[model samples]
Target: MPTGKLEWGRILGRLSPYTIQKGFRYLKHFGFKEFWIRLHERFEPEEIPYGPWYEEYRPDPEELEKQRKRKWKNPPKISIAVPAYQTPEKFLRQMMDSVLEQTYENWELCIVNASPKDASMEYILREYSRKDERIRWKKLEENKGIAENTNEALAMTTGDYVGLLDHDDLLAPNALYEVASALEREPDTEVIYTDEDKVRGEELEHFQPHLKPDFSPDLLRSNNYICHFFVVKKSILEKTGGFRRDYDGAQDYDFIFRCTEKAEKICHIPEILYHWRTHESSTADNPESKLYAFEAGKRAIEDNLKRSGLTGTVTQTKDYGFYRVKYPVIGTPLVSIIIPNKDAREDLEKCITSILGRSIYSNYEILIVENNSTSQEIFDYYRQLSENPKIRLLRWKKEFNYSAINNYAASKAKGEYLLFLNNDTEVITSDWIEEMLGFCQREDTGVVGAKLYYGNNTIQHAGTVIGIGGIAGHMFVDMPRERSGYMHKASIIQDLSAVTAACMMMKRQVFEAVQGFEETLSVAFNDVDLCLRVRELGYLVVYDPYVELYHYESKSRGAEDNKEKIRRFQTEIEFMRCRWEKLLKEGDPYYNKNLSLAKWNYSLRPKD
Candidate 1:
């Protein structure tokens, strides 16, 4: 084992100690399991522990099989609401047919036809209702928009919970079965949502991950990240006052934010229970969605932020562009930049040079923790740069502990903000400092990160996707530069559950508030743990693409072999399970639920 000399600087003051203490504890509880799961997978091998708790907790195979074959004693009654307005009969009929063909026998189809003049839609819906007693169809006297139509259907729902089916979307064959089972598993779960996939022209296009808890208002502020095929408790819907008609373009997002805020518990089933249809008219298919939906989303967030008593700037763009926020800073905020490195002097130099040269804002310092360096040339280069007053050196003379080194460096930082930068990354955008600074200046922003691209000009990380099943994977991995998929919606910098730590910024108050980083993580998931803690503070975590950086990832450091990889991965599992157990049990809002190791176990490892 390697031991690094600890450099403890002036301790953080006890000012607002009450808020800080409570905030820290809240994050610890909220994030422990998520951090544990990620780190456990990263550091501990699967050979060390074969079966997961689910296997142990699950019924015997024979018993499960017997139960599966058994008839429903008390089947759940679900009201599937489809608010079809001006949608073609083919699309409307497909949606109706999917619902009518549900394996679950107890369900009702409530289609509030808002179609301008389509009597054919009514005829098709009526034909289905006549065939199945459960199918119910109604036409509004006037053309109420999506929000109003959804509210109309919601008003007619008498089931325990309601499931919203889009006019064009399709449900998986077993979607209702899964939702019913999840509801049975946790009766207290008032809100239940599952993962979904994207379909275009009747062909499956791509899969989207399911998110956990899905309640954290800050996470909702970033985007309507959660796909809403929710089986929400009718009472919770009523309590939250159902859907607001004002948010026409993005009513589901507004209603979800309001409902989750009031709901007692949220349960996320990690399965692709729904298929989101994407055509030219669909928002997911249109790049300009950010223009219309995002603008409406910004208004929704501003409304929520005001209600939550948080004041921050909101930037919007008509085209695919960078969005920002500049919260007023009352005084100087200390920011600590932690870089964990090995022996790559050139990469380190480039990272530092870009920051020193491009960063417009000052009042920050860098802590470089050289980990088990075998290259004396790198050491000499450090000496050569020693004349730069802002850089400080800390050596981890033993085995590399990525988390431990950052924790050590953070103790030495005097700034009010903490930034974790990869040594192999270089700043590409000059306002990167202000881009991040503007976010942290707000009291509500807990973590801020930049978009990272590889040297080949491909994305390294746009955002982290929780529950890729092993060691939390990132979305849009290795995707080309022309693609503006999620980032398009994420363009307007706002609240997210977590942001990548590669080039992250957070308030110093938040850093100490979370008690720095957890050292047990050693190599992986330290940043994720930090981000989760930031969310616990009831603040927003943002990924600002405007603050761009080029990351030459894993070049200096060699890849961990199979055994080492498992060690890191196992630790990640344990950390996430322990810290964010609620999220794991519920699901992470930002992570795609469509992926499962149970489905594609062999492809779990990154493709070479």
Candidate 2:
């Protein structure tokens, strides 16, 4: 139960007088039910929790001392940039003090006081600057936009790297130390970001941490997940031209996208180093207050796409800042739909019927491998389905092996792309193939999986996480569909470590390149193993919620009922552990280590 920023966050603001006021605001905007549900979910305890986890994980006095004395051949100084505009005296003092208390010494605080008329602001800035020679400030003639104000601050930096800091936010004492340490490991790193949590009210109680994954391009295209504690090598900052006033509201988003586009090595420190202060007017507190920012974010993603020689239509989703990018089908390339079936006539019938009847992307073929089905009706149905020119049936006379069966069919596949679908599923989205194909068509993407729901409209598989339930399990399992489900994760497009093969789409070459699925993995974890290998080859495994489907997998099909079945399942588990030992032990890079691995929900890490 560690922290929740399921997009960048879900349960964002901590409970406080201000938070309660915001709750009433939500009640007015969303009516009573949605607000009530949100409040109720906050108390629904999960396997891991955040508050205790942070305290346990946070570096103590001894660790801080070690960091202070840590040797370096040539330590890099990080310049802290702050653009102050009528900032409250309380907030200004806390922000300055946070920098002064840094365990890492060789850093400077660069501030641009845009509020020149506010004499008290000048006095506080003068006092702090006098106290520490490292602290410096410049007063502007008049308040320029945020972008220009930041540029003034950026102009003052002489450090090797420049980090963005809001005037009212706090920084962990080890924040600079962590940045310097990561830079040591990756000396060539251009862009570095750290995980962040929200601090609210007079107490500044940290809540709803945004524990981020490793640098994900697709996830950044969705939302500014690299929002806080972001530092860029000085060269990249100069190259990206700092920031633009055109994207004033979301200047950081625009700047981040540009910096990442040019960055050779982007490093992420999973520890929560940044504290985002949430107030009524702050973007961290209220999304609607900054529609202009979200709109600017859309433009940012669009520009990034254009710069990469890729084209996509970007649109903001219902979730305030989260977006959706529709990548165009490159050239209507052929897709081969590969489905492995056994003696399940009804399931096979529905599956085949849905794809043939619903899929709008018509340039495709279906490779249905009949894997030793005992039923006569299944054979009859296969015969009927084969009548369609696009549908081809191949017989797998050998005993049931999910990997082998798919491999046999894949060998016979003619199309460029391979979509492995399960018989227990029905297509929900009309353009599901095109949706999956959009991401699959990307050169860097190796596999794409669909969002699956049970017949009851609860989520079955949004994505797959390694080290969950002792192997890998579908994330957001059985969560209600209507709810945004942790930072609108159920709706946004992002990269994942693995996805269920039930409805996975990938390039045929990628499948062949990875040597197809591991035949040794007979049934369980075969898909996960395939994805893990695909990822090993340095290709992205994407989870596209836009490609929706209903999976009728039996919920009651819990554990193997007999000893032989149980033994086979255990072997599969053992095989996954043995083969992908590093990923299992180190945890999924696409998933934050601070989050829970015990449950489907991205709960906080559990208490010891």
Candidate 3:
């Protein structure tokens, strides 16, 4: 079997045929420039260089020493728990040493050894315990499973906050310090987690960093994205009853889910504070060794849904650890798909035909708002479309104002839900409306966005992250449709700050609550502004990958190549900055602070 670099080559070899077909299709729709971009992305190196990021991440030795020496006023004591079972002496020492080297002194390392007969492991534990009173060791008479062992370690904790660490993993030198800092900043923070990376081979080369967003419940349900360096208030952990025996392999996932459910505030530190060891025996290196873990994770998600009073079914995807959640539709509310079009008859026809022919949902109306189309063919097409009882034609005699056209059409919409769809977009998912409706109907959700692919099957918009291009930009743009994004986020249902209005669904109530779109800002950033306002109303903006579509993005409007268009775009950018200055400065809650704001893909941000 191929391994390492050869593995990707082998995989690519198998995908070449399908890739070629997809490439040709893209060329047919998007032309040569898009095809070339997709081709380049297909073979681009997946491993992102972390050298500059590490330089930015690493703290000064003198500053760290000062932090170690300084006294904190009434600092909360944190207990670090490690469950050991036949652990190697080398790995065991490294794990214990990481805790010992912490800059924050108000911490206790609790080790519960399940391997009773391992003399070397026991000796190392005894030596560490003898050196510092903070290091506590408990040797079990018999070998218990991971969950039971972890519970034993938890039982030893007397601190206000409790943290879980894998036996083979290594914590960063300043992990506890950062956790303490965040706690100092947010006293109400009940659940705290930090970003982590995987250390592979004997040299302990760190790579595959999982830079996570700030407390995303939907993202957590999709997978255990918040895996390592997890800390929680001891009271909350006690309420959750620690770990479950049934979910031994995924006990941490289950525990974290329960903790989050009851947490007042969940905080995420963007720095890498944990190093997950990726040896052959480690699950990080070979997930096939622990197939039961994924199954347990699915069960955990299902239980969470049940507890939250949500009607949903969770299923595992082809991607090893990722999951798919199908939220049950609450009611068969009429959905009015409001599409604004000027010309582009072929694009409009294709979009309408896809919806009428492929959609499984029965109750929906198509409202195509014609904005000054002079062509007779467009008029003839409109006449034919009017023949269909499900289609409605709304006329907007004014100049092309995307926001205004949508607002006018929305006023005429009679459905409970409003679907803002681009004329250039075609449906790829049969139950797209059903999927979107599921999220929109939820009490907490305001806007529901679908995963849009470029005509060639490359991602157009997975979700929108604020601060990209100094305002807002699409996430995972130009990525292949087949891949499971940074952390399988592109393949799962997750909460985002915003999703494009190009193909978005929202309740009619939410649209009115946020006063529809801002017409003053003519073209760009209108959808982003709308979503942000909806979020300000304390509702989640969801991005569902299952509701897939092909967005031949902006085919009707064309490019902003002219001076007037460029000036108008700049004006809109300024408006957004003025309106959402604080949010832009603080960054998107659905995106990590450590991630690059300049790039659409979740690249590491360089330090100033």
List per-prediction Cα lDDT, in the order shown: 0.67, 0.87, 0.87
lDDT of 3 by residue, 437-532 (tens): 998888889999999999888999999999998999998888778655666677788899999999999999999998999998889999999999
Off by over 4 Å in 1: 1-76, 86-90, 115-127, 198-222, 276-294, 315-331, 339-348, 368-405, 437-448, 461-502, 506-544, 553-590, 596-608
Model 2 lDDT tens row, 1-608: 22233422344543668776766777886668776656555545544556666788788889888888877877899999999999999999999999988888989999999998999999999999899999999999999999999999999999999999999999999999889988888899999999999988788877788888998899999999999999999999999888899998999999999999999999999999999998889988887688799888989899999898887999987556789999988888889888887778888788888998888999999888877777788888877887899999888899778899999999899889999998889998999999888888888999999999999999999999999999999988878776656666767889999999999998998999999989988879999999988988999999999898999983212357899888998999898889989888898898888777787777776656
TM-score of each: 0.68, 0.94, 0.92
- The candidate that wins on TM-score is 2
Q: 283-393, model 1: which lDDT tens digit per residue? A: 755434434656666667677667666676665543322334445444555567888889998999999999899887777788889888888899898997788888888
Q: After superposition, how far is residue 245 of candidate 1 from its true place, in Å?
A: 3.6
Q: For candidate 2, which ten residues in a row score worst on lDDT?
A: 1-10
Clashing pairs in 3: none
Give the TM-score (vs. native) of candidate 3.
Answer: 0.92
Once superposed on the true structure, which residue ranges of model 3 sit more than 4 Å away at CA?
1-48
- Could you tell me how far off, in angstroms, the CA of residue 465 lies in candidate 1 after the best superposition? 5.7
Better of 2 and 3 by TM-score: 2
Tell me how many clashing residue pairs each candidate has: 69, 8, 0
